[model samples]
Structure formats: structure tokens, C-alpha cells
Target: ADHRVSLPLAALLGAAFLPLADVAARVIDRPAETPVGILVAAAGSPFFILLARRIGRR
Candidate 1:
């Protein structure tokens, strides 16, 4: 629960997530590539909404 630990863990997870998303983008479209932002946003939006809602509740 410490910021020190959570920050680094978040960074590591983000680093890991981007590459996986990028790979998915490349593979998903075959001859073309999906924009990484689109993939990232699509994946992140729901989480962001949930986080916002949780914070709002607090």
C-alpha cells in the first residue's frame, strides 16, 4: 500500500502492458497496424472509469 512500492509496480505494469498491446495491434490487422493509442485507450478506458468512480465514492 506504500506509494513507494505501488508507484514502481505501476510503472512496471505499464511498461509490460505497452509492449503486449503493441504486439496485439500489429498482429490484429495483418497487413496494417492498429494505432497503439487506440489499443491503449480501449484497454485503459474502462479501468479509468472504474477508478474515477471509486475515487468519486471516496
Candidate 2:
């Protein structure tokens, strides 16, 4: 994949994902709030692991 395309796609996906994660943090705890970082890390860790593995293989 081209970096030109991949970078913009990643940026767009991040732009879309952040608000959804923020909403989830608010709703998940109901009367309270969960930290947005927790949700982001939970959602992102798998992808980061996968990327790390892919890079390691190269």
C-alpha cells in the first residue's frame, strides 16, 4: 500500500473513531464517566500489537 493513501485513510479513520470512543466512554459508565484513554487503549491495543508483529516480520 502507498503511504500517500494509507496516511490519509488513517487520519480519516482516527477522526471518525475518536468521537465514537468518547461517546462510548460517557455511556458505558452511565451515571459516571470512564476515561477516554482507557477506551482508546482498549480499542487500539490489538491493532498496535498486530502492527508490531507485522513490522517485526519485515
Candidate 3:
């Protein structure tokens, strides 16, 4: 019934999975495309920052 509790848990899960996913992708090393680690993070930084600021404002 508590949205706040679930939100934090989901965020924590996402934070944990992001790094793990990147690490696994790099290790896999596909022949077609080199595994890219942290590409999502790199691309998402700006959007994440903007989101954080907006959330902080509220």
C-alpha cells in the first residue's frame, strides 16, 4: 500500500542491475558489435540529471 517504499526498492533494483548488465555485456563480446559497457549510463546521464532536478523541485 506504500508507494514510497516500492519506488525506492525499484530504483535500487535498477541501480544494481545497470552495472551488472553492462559488465555482462562487455564480457560476452559479440563478434558483430563490440559489447558496450556503460553506454546506457553515458547516454542517460543528461536525462537522469534533468529528471532528478525536476523531482527535487517538487
Best by TM-score: 1
By TM-score, the candidates rank as 1, 2, 3
**Model 2 residue 37 lDDT score:** 94
Per-candidate TM-scores read 0.93, 0.89, 0.49
Question: Tens-digit lDDT track for model 1 on 5-35?
Answer: 9999999999999999999999999999999
What tens digits encode model 2's per-residue C-alpha lDDT throughout 1-58? 8999999999999999999999999999999999999999999999999999999999
Q: Which residues of candidate 2, in runs, are more than 4 Å off?
A: none
Model 3 error, position 42 (Å):
20
Clashes of each: 0, 0, 0
Error of 1 at 9 (Å): 0.2
Which has the better lDDT: candidate 1, or candidate 3?
1
Clash-forming residue pairs, model 1: none
Local distance difference test scores for all models: 0.97, 0.97, 0.74
The segments of candidate 1 whose C-alpha lies over 4 angstroms from its true place after superposition are none
Q: What's model 3's overall lDDT?
A: 0.74
- Taking the tens digit of each residue's C-alpha lDDT, what string does model 3 give over 12-36? 9879878777776666666543445
The Cα RMSD in angstroms, rounded to one decimal, for candidate 3 relative to the true structure is 5.3
Ranking of all predicted structures according to lDDT, beginning with the best and ending with the worst? 2, 1, 3
